[model samples]
Target: MKLVLACTAVVLLLSAVELARPMRRRKNSIAQIYRAANITPVPEQILQVNFGGIKVTPGLEVAPEDAVDLPTIGFDFIPGCYYTFLAYNSNYSISFLSPSIVGLYVNLNGDMLADSSAIATWLGPSPSPGTGINRYILNVYKQSGLIDTTDEQLLSYQIDRLRFPIDDFVATYGLSGPVAGTFFLSQYPVFASEDCL
Candidate 1:
């Protein structure tokens, strides 16, 4: 009886450990961004977009298991959603690293949507050696006209004032390169209301 009880206890302990392991290893940024934007991040895969006649790739590559931080910059417009925040990149070129504005609309299923311009932020510089990170301040505008309640129009918007942090921009994105470095943007959805303002 003693031997049987000891074995049972060990089995139970191991089961408990197994259950807790996945939760412990879960990514942080995905949860954080989801909670803030009230949306979900797209599954890992290669996403391509065209910007300024250049092809761009954006997705979560660095720290694949970690959650990147995205705080609400501000809100504006009625019956619409406005998201403003800064994206930091320390592994790319200065010309490539800058503020990017992404505008998304909520579909009937409440999924955040993106268009071609979504990845337009990637048309610039390449990464250099020992680059730190570039910080960008962005303002995204969403209006009722752009919002399609029937999912017909498809949410659309533009990115403007794309610039790097003056002080540490150079060191962060490795802007000193003659060749452009490849960087990716997180595919996490940006949540917004489907109703137009």
Candidate 2:
């Protein structure tokens, strides 16, 4: 009887140790992701971006240094997924920035562009006194191939820059537009957007 009790105790100890071991790695099952956002089944592709500590609500003001984690992507973000991300100030002198690490420019494939001979970075919104709530928008698009940057600042740094529309850029690759995007407004007074734009 005593021998039987000892054997039972050893079996229980082994079972506890196995239960505490780390689980095995597996493919990124996206069912949890869609459910977390309360959305429909995962599309052919989706880009998930989040600016931690940001509330997608009203009366919000954000600083430049606040960290923005790299956009979360699905398993579909393969080596072929050359994506371009742009940041815009609606009231600026009609310009856009393919924002990167330290305010430099890079193409959709994450390759650095010419004449932007600096580190890759993103310079957050530095709204002017009268800019009146700037809409700092970020749009990510799929690029079929490399697109060159024509200007040191962007395609054009002046009023003519307005012609470079993000939707059109996306459509050029036979894609509708950014699979996902999120925006936050800068307040000079109030804002026009209240959700992830």
Candidate 3:
């Protein structure tokens, strides 16, 4: 009986050792890489703003001839952070400048209804007004390949449902009083390969 108990203890110890071996190796490999590469974590930034009473700028192509000017009543976002905008009782639009690809998602009321990879193209020349805004909710992200502009089919998919989030955005922004009647977005180039106008 004593011999059997001793053998059982030894077996348990060996099993435990085997199970820990892989974890130990992984830890050591991670440590060696960290030391060799001298990696550092980047801090993230968040941006939020509230604009009241903005005007709509009319152009030959985009806005209506008699469109009224609007104000930005409520705005908040951190460029690199995961962010979402909600609006109510209003339409929303956004335009991306050179090199920055914009992925659009829209939720009607409180329900998510649409997501697209391409809302508009701003590659070669800037639009007539040089900026874009809509009276709607606009969610922005800074990840690559989130909006694919290379394929025609995919681009159509994005544009077709691009206006999904307008209502919720208007409500949220309008709660603070009447909004500027337009939600404007301005984007700049992140790389030399990208150019706007």
Candidate 4:
């Protein structure tokens, strides 16, 4: 009778242990953003633009990823959304990066590298060598409509300014956009052989 009771006690203990099994809670905060619906409600990806403390010299092939804090996961963007990134070298009398005003890359897809509906490629910063601390004025504007965007670009071209061309670019284009971020990096003279591919 004592053996049967001991066996019953062991069974009960095993059942209790099984019932007390541990379960891990989920940690994905944005996982529940999507649900079963006609129009899938996708969460907006937050974009963070930053220059990774890289000193850019003359004729450097500085990719956009270098400007980004994290290259593996660069600027977060949404498809079908239009965005424009503009940069100006405040140290220079004229901007070699953006020869024209308000358009480093205009009407570009927020997610992709190229401007699908564009006539040219992205113009990067080309601060003249020996310049000290060129404050690159960077801005990102969300296009509300294509017509106004085109109008703004044309209006920006009409403005003729020797200094603070970025100001004219902003005012003419009605940029009124939030400055995504800014960087102050120097460009010094380096030998042709010193260039990095």
Cα TM-score per model: 0.29, 0.43, 0.23, 0.43
Clashes of each: 18, 8, 40, 0
User: Residue 163 deviation, candidate 1, in Å?
Assistant: 4.2
lDDT of each: 0.31, 0.44, 0.31, 0.42
Off by over 4 Å in 2: 1-60, 64-76, 91-121, 148-164, 167-176, 188-197
- Candidate 4, residue 116: Cα displacement in angstroms equals 4.4
For candidate 2, write residues 42-81 as lDDT tens digits: 3333334344645432123555445243322222343655
Off by over 4 Å in 3: 41-197
135-180: candidate 1 lDDT, tens digit per residue: 2212232222222233322221124323434234223322221111
In candidate 4 the C-alpha lDDT for residue 6 amounts to: 100
Prediction 4 TM-score vs. true:
0.43
Q: Write one digit per residue (lDDT tens) for candidate 3, span 59-130.
A: 112222222222122233223322222222122224322122223322112112132222332221122343
Candidate 3: 10-residue stretch with minimal lDDT: 39-48
Best by lDDT: 2
lDDT minimum window of 10 residues, candidate 1: 173-182
User: Candidate 3's error at 137, in angstroms?
Assistant: 32
- Quality of model 4 by C-alpha lDDT: 0.42
